[model samples]
Target: MEDALWAQLQNTGLEEHDDKDRIEAESDDEEVDVQEELSVPHEERLQGPQTGPKGVKADHEYHQQKKLVTESKARAEYNARLLAKAPMTTTYLQDEANKDREELLILQAEEEEEDDLKYYREKRLRELKNMSRQQRVFGTLTTITADEYADEIDEEMGDIPVLVHLFDESIPTCKLLDEHLRGLSNKYSLAKFIRVSALQLEFDLVESPAILVYKNGILIANLVRIIDEVSTRFDIDEIEDVLTRHGALSENDLYDLPTNYA
Candidate 1:
């Protein structure tokens, strides 16, 4: 019985070894199938040598270097164009801006000057117009004439000329000269000339029997006593001779003085 049991044990061990061998062979086949399934074709996969951490880092750095070189070239071209355009663009814009400023200032100054001139001219014209309107004509000298002179004279004498009587007709020598005075008055007419009676005009004055010369309602001078009286008298004949010398007197012979001195 002992010998039979020992043989049976040996047979059992042999069976276990065979089963182990079969399991190992099946596992090897399955590993081969999995590797084949996971792998791509030789043409499709990257065919290269085996790589490590250092090789991979080097490949990435090469791509980065190429990208940096391309970007730097593009940036340099753009900066060059920008720098070239700077001087012309800035100078043109600045000149245009300054011209506009100058034009505006000139227009403003001209407007102010025109306004000032207009204001001054208007002020001066207004003052002159007012002064011209508020002036008087007659003066204080109009109050001194006597009653007879008032009756003989008109109020509006206004720039008219007059003649005068020099000698008294009461004297015989003056009476002889009265004919010559009448002849002189006839010779120069339109001289709104007159003769004063010597007795009437000789009051309140040192020289008597004199011819009073008048123009524009003011007494100019008098013709005093003289020898030749008619042709050679140095009289102040303002209405005739003096005004003729100055070219201001007109003599139209239609209006004549009455010979009341005769």
Candidate 2:
């Protein structure tokens, strides 16, 4: 009976050991399951592209990002290639100098164009005034024989310059001067021209051909028949110049001649 009791006690001990082993095995399985639930997946831990806040990778935004990156790279390459042609100096002054030079050339060109336009405008105005002066015409010469015509000469005095030739018809120089005076009368019709024989005036001729210039009712000059300031046979331009210088013709008369007529 003692043997039977010892055998029963051994059996009970074996059963308790078996139960403890089963419980430890089940606890190990539960610990493995808890570890799996707490840890993250390998894909979720990777440093991938930023999706939206809800973790969605949109197709349109991904394509747009790729296009922007490609365009940025292309622009950077193009700028680098262009800048290689003209490299910057240590101070970057060489690039700035070229830019300033280009700007100066553009400004100088604009100023030259403006100056040329102004010169043309002034030239055209002068040309028009000269044309008008040449188109004007004056009247005929008056031959005075008696003092009765002096009143008529006095009336016309101050308005125009009066050029008078006192002549002795017997002198050959006087006859030549009379013809030249008549020609001048037709040209300067604005001025009054007169011829008076000294014999008709009952005066003695100190000189055969005497010219008197009068302006504004006063005598300006008395002269002999001379041209070219020295010789008798002279150019018409010289005659015109002489008349203009002496106040018979105005300053505007000089501009009426062509440039080459001098």
Candidate 3:
């Protein structure tokens, strides 16, 4: 009986030893498999499961979600930068709108100012034309008698200047003065010019060629023996110089003369 028990015990110990060796071998194999899997590239490992339809769909979904997360992060960063640059979007937009409105108003004001200048320019031209037409109406010499002097010369002469030539038609100097007076009347249309016989004015025949200047119904100048007052012989220029010196003609009057007159 002792010999049989000893054999059974020896057999059981051998079987346990075999079972431990097998378990150890299997654990070593599993460790080698884990090491090989770790050695493979990460992309190849992912591709292994992605070869199947369900694995491929799961992989696509995972990449899609990752891409969405990355894009969302980038969008958030961009928005943060924009906010740092300009925190008040409404105020910034309002300022830009106000600047545009101001520029428009300034442009409109400039246009209005230009229009006003044009209008005034046209009005001034019309007034000048009307004045020029009025000046041309009285461009001739008139003959008057002593009886008509008050009505024609005195009362008729308001602020305008009047030139009266007292002469005898037979006098040589008187005839010369009459010719000059005719030309000056056309030249200086603003001044009234008239001729009367010296005898009609009760003046001496020796003073036949006399000149009288009147303004505002008052006799301002009386030049008797006109040849002696200027020279023995005088031209239109000398007569004009004398009249200008006496304030009968002014620079403004000369400037306002008709352009058609020489």
Show model 2 residue runs off by greater than 4 Å.
Answer: 1-138, 224-229, 232-239, 251-262
Instruction: Give the per-residue lDDT of model 1 (tens digit) for 33-110.
Output: 667645746433233321333367645665666677678889999999999998666577789998999999999999
Error of 2 at 24 (Å): 98
Model 3 off-target regions past 4 Å? Answer: 1-137, 255-262
lDDT of each: 0.52, 0.65, 0.76
- Clashing residue pairs in all predictions, respectively, total 3, 2, 0
lDDT of 2 by residue, 1-262 (tens): 9999999999999999999999999898778766663464644433234343324454455566767778999999998887886454334586688889999999999999999987886777576556446543234556877584466457654456777777887877777766666666666656777888777877666555666777766777656544425355654565556666666666332222222221
Could you tell me which 10 consecutive residues in candidate 3 have the lowest summed lDDT? 253-262
Q: Could you tell me the TM-score of candidate 1?
A: 0.29
- lDDT digits (tens) for residues 127-242 of candidate 3: 65687666533557799889988777755545678888888987888988888888777777677888888888888868448888888888888787668757756898888878
Off by over 4 Å in 1: 1-146, 151-159, 201-208, 226-262
> Candidate 1, 167: how far from true, in Å?
3.5
Q: TM-score of every model?
A: 0.29, 0.39, 0.46
Indicate the TM-score of model 3: 0.46
Best by TM-score: 3
* lDDT score of residue 4 within candidate 3: 100
State the weakest 10-residue window (summed lDDT) of model 1.
135-144
